[model samples]
Target: MSERVMPGHTDGLITLGAADALWVDLTTDSAVPTASGAFTSSPAQARMGYVLLGGHAVATVRAGDGRWSVSEGEVRRAAAALNAVGMDRQDLVRIGPFRGAPRQECDEEAPLRWRRRITGELGGPERAARREVGRPYHLAGIDWRQILVEQTRDGTHRTWWLPRAVVRLLDAAEHAETQARDAGDRQTTNPEGPTATPRPYNKELEGQLYSVLSRKPGTSRRVAGWACAVCRGAPATVLDHCHEHGYVRAPLCQSCNTLERPDHLYSNDIRVANRYTRLFHTDTDDWLRHWHRCPGCRARTTLPLPHLAAWTAHIACRSLRPTHRAPRGRKPCGVLRVSWTGSQNAPRSGLLTVAVDCCPSGEHRVLAQVPYREAAERFRIWLAETAPALAAAAGPDPLDGLPAQSRPVIADTSGEGLALF
Candidate 1:
């Protein structure tokens, strides 16, 4: 067979076959290094060094650091050796220089072993390895093999291969630094961010919520049957319970449930709360108890008195700072925007301005511009009954014509004073 020169071929180097790529170490000082003492062209004469076998070429020298990219077929053979011992090719990334006892099969006291080294401009692994100095950590894509000893006719001699070798891979330390920088950027941009991610609807957790609510005193099932306590439009799929106090609050739709999360309702911004609690018509005490962060005591419980009067009494605090200032930025997908348009101190002074922006055409419509408390309640009723989407969700208002005794056993007409949202 005639030999054809491969692209990017080096001068004075022979193109070795794929079968010889694994055994032959490509690292050498001479123009051509052989494994054996014989100068005749043979596979066994090739020098030993770290090899990167999985590339398309039969053998390609990357650098003078004794590294070679060998053929794919040879790489699989090396990978099979690792697989035979319950090791994976990916494991090479994490296992930094196999420090454990050498394979019992090998006769030599110290045989050529795999080692990990840093290469390229991927940053230093020194600092990343500091915390785990004694332990093994992951590097990106490289593995190395130290010098091999052979008993030759002349004498026992060590190959030109270095003991502690190098390769290139994704540095774990740099990855961590990148994550920290991203977190910092998020904090700087949105100071009022959520502390935790909202959990997805869980059926098992929902059953637990129902079990707990059944034992609780004031959780009446007749309040709003089958409809979400928040947005009466969607079906009540999530059973919302206060994670801190371990008390059941109300049944909420998946969308509305996320709004009631501590992370979403973190601030004292009433407008934000109002938008979330727009259609909430349940035991107001439960809502207040779950999320009312007292301005005076800085406590998040509705203790001493768990009613509307208690919330009004605990509104003012010496250390309280105004949270209703114009937001630094607007959310990308806010469906509802609420703002107080008049004096906030006076009882009936401000107009609870509410705008709906969740339209398909992106049209922002002012749904309500009414006074606080009583007017807000009326607006909620009007929206639920008249809006095409909400009217279907509200489902004819269960209390339309039921007998006074049968309709909603609990008389909760405290929707006005319960504007604590």
Candidate 2:
């Protein structure tokens, strides 16, 4: 043991032998001081040893021969000096000279005191090994002074320098772990977790299947089936659940999952519409009109119309649409005729027209005209059949001003003589 170093002790650097360890004696006024200081001799040394003198002090240690002095106002300068000499928190080993205060007093004041000292002496919590101990000191009316020791290794001899690369990797790993822990904490605290349990269906498996299909873009049913079986999901369009667990898996295609429901199936319907739209490079509106239905409400209304324009823009940028061509024998359906009549002798009808000049070569030209009411009915039926599971899953419709069993239909009819049924 050596005599305690005073506040204005002479600044000096020294090297320790292989069998010897450097020691520091720190003295301060209170156990929780506002400022502190440390000293080291060599810039290369990474570890140090510390001892408490008369007064109490909080101390951090590292491996090094460098010497430093810290106090209420000079703690930051001392730490900066150590950093300027290439010494960091990882180089520290132990801290001492602390007269432990009562747990209540420490709990209230130690954090604030520690935070300030850390800011000045250790940079932050990341750089130091922290400890608090109650030990008797010779000095009177003084609580403690902060002291630090660092360590490094050389060959078989333990010294105080930590490799910079190791320090960096450890820091990164610590950061990643901290982020993951934070995410887990948030998940646990979320109110929705208690009320809305995630439909446990193996997202990783689904992602794997998505990866396979996304790679080929147009894989066959057999290939898709094999992949789906391995991935544990339904095919690419229909919704499947674990029969034993009721957990919803990824959807299968309509051709693959033939189950139908009397009500709307929201999830399956959305999946099917989105899937076929991706496959055909067609707009969501087109997919919904030709294939999709609402499972929540069993509605055949243009489900994708709201998102159609955005989807179109996205797919267009991807160059997914086919080139336009002229029809072989008929023209293109470019014009639509709508008629409305309020008289008893006349009826209302809407007719769509085809322009023969714009028809694609070798393609058949057929005019597709339907009554608004009929279209609506077809859409409802499509929804009930395509996404039966979704309909069941939804339990009940949430929309306002709509019946649970029926949906409104649109009628498209020409204003002609009102003689026919």
Candidate 3:
């Protein structure tokens, strides 16, 4: 067999025939150098013949002749060897002569292995064609071998048929890209003054604004006004740097700004309370509670309070509570008396009462007259079971609605009120 060496960063594409089958000698130090060609070539005549002798890289071989095919197992082995050599699956781009042959067992196992090796490397796999042929050494000197391979990157222009309106929108996006580039260039160059610092642009703010507009909620002027409100200033002159960095001072109202004080927002006590409440509501709370410590004050006094009336109402509606009407005949079967005691100094003051009667001879009967507190405990148990189901039925859980990383944590503790609770 004759051998040749072509050296460069550019891809080497060699065409081989039956008699011109390339014998790849990878044992040499310079055969497949770390910086040079890290690939191999062989002919797929009557049998697929390509040996990965020795190299710290992957080898891709395609059949030149249409007589032989490459099996998926071969591709998988090649990929595995490459991976062992510290090369990622993505490093092996393509392998194949990809000529023509009769249809046979495509041996999809290889491609699947390739997928497993390179799962999530890209979004997913693309569609491609395959062929099969005969060879001398098919798995130990057989007559035929199955060859399966796909193109790494084809320069095929994929034309997307779009509606005229969509085409117009795409044209608008192209124009926007051009305008953005021009704006960026302008921002970089201080052409007007000699020593003036170029104003830094906020890409995040621009993106956020773009997101709002893409919804097409209202007119540009109205949207601009809302953006200004968010910025807490004239939208045109508002330097967006602070807003982009999550500085709450930008778009909030004065009241909200005051409410979101440094002491209040980042307080360890508040963070711990919030986290405790969140944990109390989630199924993962059991696991998270062990590791859940306030990063702010490093305190562990946080507790979940039933402050949300709406949630309480939801719990009450789902519980087996009695109706408003009293029973007709007085029967000493069982009585469920519920009463609410209000604190005198509480913001909201009210007394609530509920009574349930049990039927003596009927299938349904009350067990005992339990305290409202006990009933509340029972409600909590029911919530622990049914809240998730109710959340599922209502749509997504509120906790799930939070961004993956924005689950909240105290970043610092430098205040007097840094207690966890």
Best by TM-score: 1
Give the whole-model CA lDDT for all candidates, comma-separated.
Answer: 0.30, 0.26, 0.25
lDDT of 3 at 51: 21
> Mind giving the per-residue lDDT tens digits that candidate 1 earns over 1-421?
4334353433234334432332333322211121321111211112322222211011233336543333433333433422332222221112211223232321112211122222211124553564354332222112222212222224642112211111111111122222323344321212122112223222322213334566666443232234554444344444565432333455654445434421111112222333223323443333432332221111211221112221221221102211222377533333444444433234366454444445444545555554545443443354344343433333324333322321111221332212122
Candidates 1 and 3: which is better by lDDT? 1
Give lDDT tens digits, candidate 3, residues 33-123. 1111112221111121222212111122444454432222332333333233321222121111222312232241221112122222222
Name the Cα RMSD for model 3: 23.9
lDDT of 2 at 77: 28
List runs of model 3 lying over 4 Å from the truth.
Answer: 1-309, 318-340, 343-372, 387-421
Give all TM-scores, in the order shown. 0.21, 0.19, 0.15
Query: Stretches of candidate 1 above 4 Å error?
Result: 1-238, 241-256, 259-268, 271-370, 373-421
Candidate order by lDDT, decreasing, is 1, 2, 3
> What TM-score does model 1 achieve against the real structure?
0.21
Q: RMSD for each model, in Å, please?
A: 24.5, 26.6, 23.9
